[model samples]
Every structure is written in structure tokens, then in C-alpha cells.
Target: MRHAILITAYTDFFHLIDLTNSFNEDFDIYIHIDKNIYVSPICLKILQSFPRVKSAEQVFHVNWGGRKHVDAILWLCKQALSLSTDAEYFHLISGTDLLVKDLQQFCNFFDKRKGTNFLEYFLLPYQGWESGGLNRLQYKHPLDQLNIKELHDRNVYNRFVNWQITSRRTRPLPNYPIYGGSSWWSLTRDTVNYIYQNYNQNGWYDRLEDTFIPEEMFIQTLLLNSPLKESIVPYNLRYIQWEHKHGSIPAILDEEDIPKILHSCALFARKTDSRISKKLINYFNNNRSSNL
Candidate 1:
């Protein structure tokens, strides 16, 4: 079965080269680079060498904690789905994540468990969530961009209008139980298609368009509420360490984390900066060679 690596990248081109090269040609890559990033000729050459790597011509200027971030993922998903109608699954990963296992191994794992989605999720209003994560569903803003002029355009009335109008969510609470999880997931093409269709056809995306960090909620809630929940494996297949509580970024993984990464049984590990740890790369190379 073919897999699509749907990546949302902003920086580190060589790292991206390392990432894309690691996966064989069988797995097509669909990437959405940040609009602000300029791709150098050499980087473009490297990416072009991969026959299946497709980059967006009109990349989105994604903003953290905003709907644009969700937009980026959706854009990549659309491209990936278009890449191949028969692509079995799409694994949402970042540029910072590296494959810990060989593609053959990963395929074997997925093939054995065909029809099951490796998506980690939890029913929302869980422990440690302030307001039971309800604020993520209630509020919507204009989503100020990074430009000074854009940010300055906000006024009291705009804020009031956003809060007053966006606060009134049309999606009935408890009827559709909200779900939460990490941004990365591996789901079937049908599941991803379902999300894209539901997002457009239903009012859930509009309700979440202004909500803070809606990426973690919008897709998860839909999956949990759908019949596909029975096919979920409950593991994201990625090993990422959230060292800092309430931290927006995962800690940069190093050689020291290699053992734990190897032990986690995850197909990939996140935030692994190759510059920080060549040893980690060597570890993967050595281990992957042995597995081969």
C-alpha cells in the first residue's frame, strides 16, 4: 500500500532534504512551505530530485495559534490526495521529524493492520485543561497577521464583534463531543477525505476558524465523533517529547534521546535537528541498515 507524507514546513531546507530523501520514491511527499520562506535554487534542485515530492506554488502564510495553521495542513492534504487516488494513507509530519524505521518496515506494520488508523486522540474536557478546553470552541478572532499594519487594524469594535458574534457557537455542545490531540496523525485516505468534506459541508470549521490552536481540535473532534473512531489505533506512530508543560514547541531531540526513541516503537521522532546531533542520524542509519 502506498503512503503519502504530508508535511508542513517553514525552515531548514537541508533538514528537509534529509527528511525527503530518507523515504523511498514509493511514498510521495506533499509539502506546504511557509509563504515567507524563500527556496534557494540548490534546495529546489534537491527537492526536484525526488520525483514524487510536490510543493505548493501558492504557500500559505501560516500563523501560530490561528486558523492559517489549519489551512496549511488542509492545503497539503488536498495536494497529497490529488497526488494519487490510490494512496492508502497520509501521515501528517513536520520537517523536523525523521523516520526511525525503514519504509519497508513501516509499510509492513501498516499493511498488517490495514483499515486501522494510527491517530491518537482523547475526548476533550480532560484533566489539566483550563475551562475544560471550552474556550478553544467558544472564541473567534480576526486572526491578526504578523505585519504591523495588519495587527494595528484591530479595534475595540472588531474585538467586540469577534467575541460577541463568534462566541455564539452554532455547534451544539455535548451533542458532538469535542476531541483533542497532537497535530501529527496517520489516517486513511477515506478518513482524510471525510474530514475535508465534513469541514466544508458542516459548520464546525467556521466555529473553529477563529479559535486558538484549532488544528489540535477540529480534526480530532470529527474523528472521535465519527464511525471511524472504531478503526483508530490510538497511537500517532511518532515519538515526540513535550518536555515543557504548556510549551508550544517540542524540545529539540538529541543523541541522549535516541535510546528512548528507539524503545518507543514509534516509526518517527520529532524535532530532531541534525545539526544538533549527527550521532542521532548515525544511529538511525546504523539501525535502519541492521533492520534492512
Candidate 2:
């Protein structure tokens, strides 16, 4: 069965090259680069040179915890679906992610579960998020207009959130249940088509315009509240570390973490760095022929 690897990336072009190289003819790669960053021309040329790779014609300046991130993902999904209508599955991942499994093993795993949607999700009022995560949707978060990397902008955003909280100002929740989870996932073509169709027909796109980190909630919420809910598998099949270390959350994977990554059932691992993950990347590259 053919697969579409849809990627949303801003940095680490070399790692992205390694990622795309891992797949074979059975997969078509679609990438959406964050328009805010200046990518080297050589990097873009090299990426486009790949036989099965396609860079998105429409790009967005994605901001963290903003609606634009969700928009970019949806755009990537749209691009992939439109171009590869026959692909059976589409896997969403970041540029820094490395495949932990060989192409054969990865395809085999999905081949056996033809219709399953693999993602990490939990219903709202989840303890993992602040105020049960309702605050994200209940307040106006103008993250798209503000650069989170700027100290002044971050301060302004924080004060705005605090003011909204103190004043008890909140918008009404959507009429349906809200679900949240990791942004990455593996979905069947049918499920993705359903999301695209429903999102456009329903008013969800406008409704989520100012929601915080809607990327994590948009797809999960849409699927869980529909007939396709039964096809969802709770695991997203990606290994990610949540522990904060070296000043990074979802701690950057390194050579030392190879054992844990290999032991996990994840098909891929994320948040890798070109500098920190050189050994880890080399390990996988050297052993690409193996079934690990």
C-alpha cells in the first residue's frame, strides 16, 4: 500500500534529508516549511531533487501555541490528499523526527491495521493540562499576532491571559466534546478526507481562530465526536520524552537515549538536534538495512 509522509518543519534541513531518505518508493513525501524562517537555497534545491518529495506551494508563518500551526498541518494534509489520492495512509511528523523502524517494519505494522487511526488523545478536563485544558479554548489567545520568542511579546501575552483569568471572562464551549492530544498522528485516507470535509462544512475553522495550541485539539476533537471515533487507537506511535532536561522540554534525543528509544514501541522519535543527535542519527543510518 502507498503511504504519504506529511511533514511540517522550520529548521534542521540535514535531519529532514535523513528523514526523507529513510523511506522508499512506496511513500510520497510532502513538506510545509514555516515561511517565517529563511531556508538556504541549496537546502531547498536538494530537498526538491528527491524523486518522491514535494514542497508545499502554499506555506504559512507558523507560531507556537497558535492557530496557524493547525492551519499549516491542514494545508499539508490537503496537499498530500490532493496529489496522492491513492495513498492508503498519511503520517504526520516534524522535520527533526527520525524513523525508529525500518521501512518494511513500519509498513507492515500499518498494513495489518488498515483502517485504524493512531494518535495520542484524552478527553477534556484532563489533569495533564492547566485548568483541565478548558482555559485554552475558553479564552481569546492572540498568539498568531505575537512572536512567542520575543520577551516583550511573551510578557504581553502572559498579562493578557492573567487579566482574562482575573476577570473570569470566558467564551462558551463548543456544542460538542473537546479532545486534546499530541499533534502528530497516522491516519487512513478516509479519516483525513472526513476531517477536511467536516472542518470546511462546519464552522470549526473560524471557531478555533484564536484558541491556544489548536493543533493538538483540532483533529482529535473532530474525530472523537464523529462516527470515526471507534477507529482511533490511543497511541500515536512516536517516542517522545517529556522530561525537561538541558533547558528543553520533550528533551532532545541523544546518543545516550538510544536504548530507551529502541525499547519503546514507537515507530519514530522526535525533537532531535543536528548537533546533539549526530550519533543517534548515524546509528539509525548505519543500521537502515536492519529491521530495528
Candidate 3:
């Protein structure tokens, strides 16, 4: 049974190298590099050194209200499926992620669920244009209250227009359902193929991906609505600390967080910066070979 370490990265290519080198487990690495990010010569060299890494050239310029992120991930999923049809599990990891356990143990734990999924689900707000549709139709936005400027540039503008002009215009609108969960997941081949085969037919997926993709919600909703919901493990194995109350993303890991990280009992922890790299290196050097 084969497994893959799939990553969607922007500027932190080196961090991947550091993590990859420490893990001796046999797994293929597939990366989606954002075209907008400027890759340095050193980055290219590091990427080439990893024999298992397949560099995907296709990049998407995702915008705040655009479907580009979803498009990029969908493209990556198809590429991964084509490259190796035998891959049992596709483990999605971020550029900022670090392994907390030995690679063998990680593989062992997942091997038990060879044909299952690790995706979870929760209903959350669907952002961008989709939100606008619910606000207008569901809340009964007055004709003058409709802001065309907000709808015109959003990726779902066309869908919104159709809904607005058609049966939705005069009918009582239903609440817009959304999804949320950990962005990271380990998907079985069966589920992966299902997504590739029915990319567009599903109304909720097509509509959801229009604004948010490769995040907590999109995959959660897709999997929940699929036959593999029974296989989903409710909790993700990553440990993340949303350091501040106001920040959208988590705080970068520093030296001070090492002890806490070592005891987190998670397979991986994310957002480690150069400040914590030495501690990370030392920890891996001391414990990388162990089952811990």
C-alpha cells in the first residue's frame, strides 16, 4: 500500500525540505507551487534534490472572492491521481507543517484505515458571493439594497444573477448551508476518484468551491455529502495554536513553544519559523528515529 505527502505551498519550500529529509518513510511527495510566488534558484535546487517530489507547474492566482484556490487543488488532485493510481492515501500537508512523530508510526496509524477518509464536517459561513445570495434572497434584501458592485466582481456573480432572476427572485429563499473543519485530510483512493469523476455535477460543491477551496469547509462538505462519510475521522491530527485573538492565521512557532510542541501528541504541528528551526532540528535529531 502506497501513501503520498501532498502539499500546496507558496514561499516556504525550504521548510518542506527540512521535514522531508528527516522522515525516512517511503512516501511520494507532490507539491502545488503558486505561480505568483517567486521561486529562488536555491528553492529550485532543494526541490530537485527530493527524488520523490513531483513539482506541479500549474499555478492559480487566487483572489479574495475567487474560486482559484479550489481550481488549483482540483487540478492537483487530478495530477496526483494520474501520476500514481496505486496511492492508497493522499495526506494533505501544508508548507508550514512539521512532523511530531516518526514517519513509520504515522504510516502505521493510517494503514489501519487504508480504505477510509480522515475528513470531518461542521456547517460554517460560506464566504464571498455565496453569502451575498443568502443575504439578499433569504433575508429579503430590497431591490434597491442589492449592491451590484459587490456581486459583479465576485466569482459566483453569474450564479447569483441566475438565482436572482429565476425562481429565487420572488420565492422565499432557504438558508445557505456551509461547512468547516481542518484543511488537512488523508483521503483514500476511492474517495479521491469520486471527487475527480464528479467535479461539476454536485451543485453544492460547484457553488462552494466558487469562493473557498483547499480550506476547512470545501472538502468537509464534499466528503460529508459523499458515501465515505462513515470513514471520516472527526478530528484532524495537526496541532495549531491561533496565538492571537485578532489574527486570521496562527502565530509563527518560536523557541519558547518547543516544550509545549514536544508534548502535544499530534502527528504534526504547523507554522514553525526560522526562530524555532534549531529547536526543531535538535528535537528531530534526538527523537526522529524513535517511535515518539
Candidate 4:
């Protein structure tokens, strides 16, 4: 099974390139660098070192908790699927992620379950949301309101969009049952194309184009509403320890977490920094399956 690994990266370009060194010739890697930040010449050279690496020519200045996050992902997927012909499986991971096993180990695992796709998905408003259960889909976050420039300065645009705001979404919501999950997954090439087509087809994409952190819901909602609903996996495959009660970034992996990561059956462990976790990364690199 040929693998197309799609990555979303903004910072830590050297670390991102180091992470890609884990996968060999068999895996084709495609990356989308956030346009908000700049990459130095040396780091960009390292990122393009491997022949399989494909970078997005048209990058987005993605804003946190903004719709551009989803757009960047779609842009990467579009490039990977278009260029790699034998692309059987597409894995979506972030810059902070490290592949914990050998490429062949992952290949053999997916080869057995050829038809199934692995993605964490939950029917939206499923009891956990305390404040706004279904309002995530109901509220409209305009592009101008969520722009990084506008919010970073915290100028009048921020004040104007706050309590004084007097606008509600004029567009009607899609009838599909909203789904929410972690914004990462391993999916089949066919399903990847399915999502890309459905989201760009017509009215559905427009309905939630401005939804809050649409990346978290767009793909989940798309998969659940389609025939692939039964193939969904309800758990995230990455072993991330969430120490913060409510924060977007997961706690960085430490040497103490090595045992758990090696035994969890998870293919990747994320938010890893090569600068800090050299001991942990070396352990996995040295212990990769000999069968590969």
C-alpha cells in the first residue's frame, strides 16, 4: 500500500524535516507551510531534501481557530492525491508529530485492514460541551473577524466583533448531523478524494465556511454523513498527554513517556521536539522493527 503523508506545519522547520526522515522511499510526504511565518533558506533546503517531499506552492497564512486551517489541509491533500498515482492511504499529521515505527511496520498494519479508515469522530454536542452544545455550528465566524492581523493587534476590529456585534448568520445550516473530533487522522486515498470533492461540490461547504475551527468538524461531518460512516474509528491514534485542563497544545513528550508510546499501538506520538527529546526519539529510531 503506497502511503501519502500530508502534514500541516507553521514553525520548527528543522524539526519537521527531521520527522520526515523516518519514512523511507515507500512513503510520499506532502507538506503545507503556513504563510504567516517564514522559513529560512537552510531549513527550506532540508525540507526539500527527500525526493518524495512535496511542498504547497500556494500556502495560506493560517489563523489559529480559523477556517484557513481546514483550507491548508485541503490544499496539501489536493497536491498529494494529484501527484502520487499509487496513493492508497493518506495520513494527516501535524508538524509536531513523529512517526514512531518503521515505514514497513505501518504499511503491513494498514495492508491487513485495507478498506477501513482510522479517524477519531464523535457525534457533535455529545454531552461533554458544557457551555455551548450546538452553538458551534450555529455561530458564524466571519473571515475578517478571524483574521490573524485583526485579532493580533486587538484593535477596533476586535471590539467591534465583541459584545457590540449585532450580526447572525444569514445562510442556512446543512442538514447533516455535525461531528467533532481531533483534527488528525489516517484515511484511504479514495476517502480523501471523497472528502475533497464533497466539501468543494456546492452548498454544504458554504454553509459552514465560517464555522468556528471548521477543521475539527468539516472532515468529521463529511465522513459521518457519507457511506463511510461505519468505517470511522472513535479514538485518536496519537499518544498525547493532555496536562492542561483546557489548552490547544498538548504537553511535550518526555523520556518518561517512551514506554507508554512504544506499547500503545499508536503509530505516532506528537508535539515532539527533537531538541528536547533526543533520548526518546533515539530509542524509537534504534528499536524500529527489523522486519522492515
lDDT winner: 2
Cα lDDT tens digits for candidate 4, 25-58: 8888998888778888777777887787866343
Clashes of 2: 0
Give the range of the ten consecutive residues with the poorest summed lDDT in model 1.
144-153
Candidate 3 lDDT trough over 10 residues, lowest sum: 139-148
Q: For each candidate, what is the lDDT?
A: 0.76, 0.88, 0.63, 0.76
lDDT of 1 by residue, 165-196 (tens): 56664334545678888889999999998887
**What CA RMSD would you report for each candidate?**
3.9, 1.4, 6.7, 3.0
Q: Write the per-residue lDDT of candidate 3 for residues 1-292, one digit (tens) a residue.
A: 6777777776566676776665443677777776667777677677757777765453675443345556667777887888866778787777778777777777788777667676645654434335533333233222222223366544345555566667645444224444566677778888877877876545654455323233555677667666777877776777777665223357666556678877775777776654445676557546866654
- Compute the lDDT of residue 20 as modeled in candidate 2: 84
Q: Is candidate 2 or candidate 3 better by TM-score?
A: 2
- Which digits, one per residue and each the tens of the lDDT, describe model 2 over residues 1-292? 9999999888898888878888899999998899888888888888889998966433788878889988888888888889997999999999999988888888899889999999899999899998899888899999999887889999999999889999999999988788999999999999999988888435777888779999988998888888999999999999999888657888888998899988999988988998888999889777766654
Error of 1 at 76 (Å): 1.6
Measured on C-alpha atoms, candidate 4 has an lDDT of 0.76
Question: What would you estimate as the lDDT of candidate 3?
Answer: 0.63
State residue 121's C-alpha deviation in candidate 3, in Å: 2.2
Question: How far does residue 225 in candidate 2 sit from its true spot (Å)?
Answer: 0.5
Q: Please, what is the TM-score per model? A: 0.85, 0.96, 0.74, 0.87
lDDT of 1 at 59: 67
Candidate 1 regions exceeding 4 Å error are: 56-58, 141-175, 245-248
Q: Where does model 2 exceed 4 Å of error?
A: 56-58, 200-202
